[model samples]
Target chain A: MSKKELIVREEILGSNKKVAAEIRGKMEAAGVLVVNLLSSPGSGKTTLLERIVETLKPTHPLAVIEGDIETERDADRIRRKGVPAWQITTGGACHLEAKMVGKLLPEIPAETKFLFIENVGNLVCPAGYDLGENLRCVLLSAPEGDDKPKKYPKAFATADCLIITKSDLIPYLPFDLEKAGNEALDLNPRLRIFVTSALKGRGIAELARYFIESRVNMIQHQRHA
Target chain B: MHELSIVASLFEILEAKARENQATKIVRVRLKVGKLAGVVPEFLQTAFDSYKQDTIAAASHLEIEEVPLKVRCRKCTAEIEKEDFVLVCPSCGSTDLEILEGMELLLDKIDLEI
Candidate 1:
């Protein structure tokens, strides 16, 4: 009963990472900025996307890939805003995998300038997978309270930007904006934060401006490099 | 919920490694999971148990080693093992710290019978 030991140091998400890189390369080549939005359910991801599409569609050819456990509803909503939208239903998976996103890229409109992939509404599993986005944004609604950063540090830490969504509810809720923003900054010092209320259209313009400027900067940087 | 998918991916890795080594049966699979990796060990174990039935790792023991979150203080250069998701420096009480060890999910090694 002699047993031999094999040292195989490999990442479980290695295949996903490789496919994500390929998708990133494709998006970059096509001059499209991809953003992956992650959050818990009812965090107003679809609402925020609706606002973004309403504002950005006039200037940019926008597309959306909505990921849900089982729904074409989000995709249908985005399509109503006059933008191309696709839905990738995971069936039972908690988060969207890179391969799943990659398979739907060819279906996106050819002239899309901005591509938003609203990841499955999950704060935990979504952090473990990268969908080859130019930016990864995690949204925390004001009603969710300030302790979310402390509770789900991985999601806050991995995010490039943290959006405090539904900020208009602060008058009714006990959400401390400063505390939540500081806590997220502590986890990830480089995170760019925005307090937005999609329903009121507050901070929507600034967020859209940031996205446009960043995408332009990335393209120029890539060209010079 | 995602642990099941993680265990499925782990099984794929284990099968490939076992095939590479010409091992007929896997004895044990060792994984290194950091606290900040967002994986629950018990959930992963349960998922592994349910998913390993018809695979090469059917009789293998799943050994998971938990790694504590470690960070380095930028101000005091203090290395601290943190719990409860606190990101402050222990020595200087500064929030400006770099994470040294955490957020790791690695398939470390496998013990197999050839």
Candidate 2:
């Protein structure tokens, strides 16, 4: 009975990281701006996507990849907007992985400039997985309260953009916008903040403008690189 | 939970490494999980215990080393470390900070019974 120790230092998510990197390369090369959205259940992600499609689809080629535990309902919503949308149901998985997205990459239209991945509704798990997104936007609905950034710091800390959704409910709820925004900004100073009420179209145009500009900048950066 | 997926990935790596090293069974596993790595240690341990039952590492012990979140203030160049994720500089109260480490989710070592 000989006992031996093997010091094998490795990354647990190395395989996923490799696949995500490949997906990023392919999408970037295709001139697509991939956006990964993270939020808790009922955070207005689908509504925001609908608004984004309404705003950007006239000029920009848009598509969606919806990740959920079940159903094609989300994809159907986007399809009703006259855009190509595919659904990846994880069955029981809480997060969407790169391999799942990479396998469906070919389904995206060749002319699409923006590909939005509506990640699984759970905030905690999806924050850990990267789906080869050029931009990661975390949504915090007004009804969800202000302590979300402090409680789930990992989601806000890693996101490139933060969208405060369902602002129409701000008048009814006791949610303090300043507290959440400030805390989120503190966690990630580089975060681009957007306050939006997709139903009322309060900040939808501004968010769409930012996305369009980001896509342009991405293309220019690629050209120069 | 996502911890199950994480543990699955961990076992893949461990099984490959054990096969490479010609180890029949894994005795212990050490993981380095940072404060911001988005992993719950308790859930990870539970998942590890459940997943290792049918594998070669049936009796394996999983050790998790939590790494603190460390950041440097861009305004004052002060280094700070804490388990609580406050990303502001204590001296200057500047939110402009650069992270040094603490985002690690690494499998550091494995002890085997050959």
Candidate 3:
């Protein structure tokens, strides 16, 4: 056997990108605004989604795709809100791949205007995988500390928006609002920041409005294009 | 860990490459993993060692070269290198930045006993 060095240059997640592109094309053709929410465990992704469902359901149709390591609890929570929800149990995987999401693309409600993908509650793994969403928002709850942006820079750096959740707990916690926001902005200067408290209903309306306006703008932009 | 997931895929590419090259066994595998590639190299090496057993790469040694974060300024068109994620261009201080490097997760080459 001859010893030879062979060059085999290949991108690792190139296949995933193709899958993500297909998903994006399908959602775009359907005129659905897909938003992917990512954060650590107990960052209130489900709570925020539930609130968003209540706010948007009366006017526009919405659907959800929940990703978790196990359990359909999140999907169940969204289902209780009367919106269509699909739960993707990753079994033992750390993140939801585009292939996993693509498998459920046909089941998405046809009349859905907005589709929310609540990514697996992991700050590290989920951020690296693209699920073909129009927007990627990362949540950092006040109780999780203000140092997360620097510690887990990829999540904040790649996020189109940063939501500082649990704002109501600021009085009882040592979380510095400006520090967290500043650190996130340092990693992603163009990130749209929002301080929200689901219990207090603060900033929820503005966020919901932003989503509505974004979908409208996207549709209009596509029309012009 | 996700490294296990990545290593599995790596083996797929390795097997295909080895077959295409008509290699009897893989001796050394070379990879270029960027700092921003979102993979822990140690974990990946460990996973590779675990998965290489009984395969064509059973006797192979995994070699990983880490690439650092590098970006280009959209405003001033300057390239900058950093140890970690930096939002703006250091020279122009422009927030309009484009990533030029440091996101690579490439299987560059492999040494095979053909």
State which candidate has the highest DockQ. 2
Off by over 4 Å in 2: none
lDDT digits (tens) for residues A1-225 of candidate 1: 568988987888888888999999999889899999999999999999999999899999989999999979999999998898899999989999999999988888889999999999989999999899999999999999998997888999988899989999999998899999999987887889999999999999989998999889879988998
Worst 10 residues of 2 chain A by lDDT: A1-10
Two-way TM-score contest, 1 vs 2, winner: 2
Specify the CAPRI tier of model 2: medium
lDDT of each: 0.91, 0.92, 0.90
* TM of chain B, each: 0.93, 0.90, 0.96
What is candidate 2's DockQ? 0.78
Candidate 1 Cα errors over 4 Å, as ranges = B74-77, B92-96
* CAPRI quality level assigned to candidate 1 from its DockQ score: medium
Better of 1 and 3 by DockQ: 3
Better of 1 and 2 by lDDT: 2
lDDT of 2 by residue, A1-225 (tens): 578877766889989999999998898899999999999999999999999999999999999999999999999999999999999998999999999999988888899999999999998999988888999999999999998998998999999999999999999999999999999987887889999999899899999999889988988999999
Candidate 1 to truth, TM: 0.95
What is the DockQ for all candidates, taken in turn? 0.69, 0.78, 0.77
How far out, in Å, is residue A11 in model 1?
Answer: 0.8
Docking class of 3: medium
